[model samples]
Target: MAGTEIFGIEEIKALTDVIERKMIHRYGSHSVRNGIYRVEEFEEKAKKITGSKHALALTNGTAALITALKGLGVGPGDEVITSPFTFIATIEAIVACGAVPVLGEIDETLGLDPVSAEKLITKKTKALVPVHMFGAAADLDPFMEISIIYGIPVVEDACEVVGGTYKGRYLGSIGKCGTWSFDPNKTLTVGEGGLILTDDEDLYFKMDCYHDHGHIHSKAHDRGEEGKFGLGVNYRLSELQGALGIVALDKMDATLEKIRKTKKRIINSVKDTGIKVRPMHDPEGDTASHLIFMLPSPEAAVNFSRAAGEAGTGFSIISQNTWHYAKHWKALEEMGEKDIFGTKAPSYAAETMAATEAMLSRAVMTGLNINMSDGEIERIIRSVKCGAKASL
Candidate 1:
């Protein structure tokens, strides 16, 4: 079964039409050189959708993360605490800024455990990155509390769950800053792009410069005028991506509804299968991007995954050793001593986060694509039943 699908030809036609218009208008400049009309529109729409005061488009989710970190002034000798159960990009962003990545345990939500994260905070701790993992909102309340108590900034990595909410507030809008990925695999696809959202004008300006080669663009500093440039890199999104993003944003609400319904059907179908399913942190709030369950044991998880594969269910068993899992980061070995700020990278491989490892080892997950047909959903439900019967 296809795991993820892109928008239809209508979206393609819209993007093409926008590109054609830009071509006709002699819009030769990229985002940095000159403001692309579509890029500006997309940013405006993104801010509205995400409920942020400012939204800056970037080349990819990784760029968004790095830019957010830089904007928060995270750097050498700073320790950023994050869950080990998230995508590698979360840790990579922290390390990219010459900061230490402190691994935190995850609760049933598969997000950073707030208590553990609070314990990890030290004088050197500069930020807290809580990933809204697999389309579910992390428990942001406690994290937000921790942030307030410690004076650390929280950067919500809402890459997977763009429209997901926690207690009625959008996932990306609760933290000091939030990021979303528009990669092909995500709910909202622009082929390849990302968004950084923030309410703080100063941080917004900082990230704006960070993503656009350090050039601060404002009313005082127009395109051609000299501005207060800083150390940064080229992470600007193209007009083509911006056009696609606009179309994707338009389709997000309906697509998310379909995904939620499909996820509900899949989850309800497996309710009597004796498998231990981890409930969403908030049923009404989560944006059901993936269906996740846990087996009785790691061995059972392996067996179930193998059986699911044989049954063509397309379910993956996430384990501690998975590349994205935190225990496997081996930060020093992976990042080496390449430092932009001449700081020694902390040894992450030595610290084993037992809770995160235990939680993920027996977990089975599958992507919930909006394009999945009813027949495919039924097939997955049947496959899960068959796999559980055979393996367990």
Candidate 2:
């Protein structure tokens, strides 16, 4: 707990030194903007690692989702079914594309419940945005089946998960388009950036052009050196970020191994504490172990968090009710009787009200940082045991 940083500051500083020395090209150059080159390089490495045909880097994770949603033709009147237990960015991206976001309950994996998800689908449903919550991939078999049945595209919100594998296949590679965030908190870090991966040629082209500025000759460069007719923003990563990304990618295997070990330690430590640790459903493959979470009774969870923090254990509430659910409630209720997201209720109003109640009453989330050392895990366990004892 003493000066245990989530990531090595010295490592980042070393990489930054290389950038400052101009050993690496900076982003935003005429030939290859420092940002553009870095983003492109990161995407290339991502493609190679994930086995995807194309990769596009955008400004941030939210922008990446927005780009994918827009590229997939999700617009006004279209609905995208996604789990409510996710970051608002997923919902924001859908809203940005003028699409209605449908709320689906989470299953064991804390991902979209296939059964509940199926109930939400309708003719207006355009895509499925299954978030790999806390680096754990959702059950893709049912998601894939639903996609095939409804003929809708799948855009995976894999921002938190980098190396998560589901059913022997990579999480991002299974969907039509997958977006990843390279924020420092994620499994991988490129300072602050996001990437989109896909095998679909058309979708790739649209996203590629959209990230750059609406118009850029594939082989050469943009027609207008000064400006362009197409549309795009400065959603690019610096070459420096890319170089750091390369270094980070090299350590992915080691990072994941360490994460798994830590997760096991934490899970085992809490086994007899009576606190129900959430299970990561990886029936097909391995989870990235981004954040180990638990959904204990709200009151107990609060007390546990307080005790842990006092004991020098870092405890975080990853999912705070805040203002996200209200927007989701309104969006879902506005869907009318189309049933774009599965619910027993006949209209969006009924479903939203019910979902709102469920989310408010329960929904506890905690995280285990990948860099957590054994001592930290022990401290956390001791705190949880103490809390459990108090409850008894």
Candidate 3:
């Protein structure tokens, strides 16, 4: 079961055909044209889906975030507020841009708490990254107000909630700029890709340069004449990946619909099982239902999982904490003394200490993929309810 895949053979075959036909590398050959075309198509499709004026295709979601942060002029000594209960890639991007990530707490909906975010802001605060974690939009109105009052930028990490909406506006489009991931595990995939969407022309131009290595191809380049303007990374997506993205983009609406239906069914099946369903915002708005979540106490979740196994109903927590964030935390801890940024001065930065301790204390999380079948979920729910009685 661990090795069994969720996607069907047709999906794999379709992706493979695109990969085979497009033939990967497009740096300095005619194949570059096809890659560029596919990327353009993906950008256009994404823009329409996200309701943004401009979209840029990039290497991966992390690159999209770093590009957005760099474009916003975030750098060393600058503090950007973000939720700690997210994939480390979000924090990694902040670190890569030489900015400090001031962690914020999450609400029941699992998004950054607007009040908590406001408390973390300071004179050096430069940006706010509100991740639409697990497919639910964060309460954006308050964050938008905070950004407005402070004159700071907001970049929505809509990676997991691309098609999700809040208050009628699309999740990513609600911010100054939004970043999305197209990894295999995401709501949609291009094998490996990302997109950045923005309404600001200047931000669009700057991010283009950031992703491309500080270079913007002239109109001639768009028309097939090669002249370098500056330096940029070769963080461009492959034609095959772009093609696959286009195909996937076409299927997004139906895919998201199925996800919503599956989510409802699973939630109903599990509601009476004495296991807690993950909290969510009103599903009527813009939840893409990316990953189903549950917030059982750690002990309860462990017991439920064990009982599930005995009943032949497999399930798992998000991951063992030892395995989930160890690499990132270990890398930070190894920095040692002077390397650990704020160690030398204990009482020096009260805010930093408070934020760090608060963030670390509230890190428990659990998730289920969107691929579970109805029967499997029902069986698991049955097992959980039975186990709850047995424990009593």
Q: What TM-score would each prediction reach against the true structure?
A: 0.90, 0.80, 0.80
Worst 10 residues of 3 by lDDT: 339-348
Which candidate number maximizes lDDT?
Answer: 1
**Higher-ranked by lDDT: 1 or 3:** 1
Pairing residues by index, what is the TM-score of model 2? 0.80
lDDT of 1: 0.79
TM-score of 1: 0.90
TM-score rank order: 1, 3, 2
Ranked candidates, highest lDDT first:
1, 2, 3
lDDT of 3 by residue, 219-295 (tens): 34542455444555667887667766777777777777765776566557666655555555646654444333343
| Model 1 CA deviation exceeding 4 Å by range | 1-6, 23-36, 219-222, 329-346, 390-392
Give the number of colliding residue pairs in candidate 1.
Answer: 1
Judge candidate 2 against the unseen true structure and give its global Cα lDDT, from 0 to 1: 0.68
Q: Please list the residue runs of candidate 2 whose C-alpha ends up more than 4 Å from where it truly belongs after superposition.
A: 1-37, 217-230, 283-364
Question: 193-273 in candidate 2: lDDT tens per residue?
Answer: 788889999998877677667755343444455344357665655667666676666667777777677766766777786
Query: RMSD of model 1, in Å?
Result: 3.3
Candidate 2 minimal-lDDT segment of 10 residues: 339-348
Candidates 1 and 2, the one with greater lDDT:
1
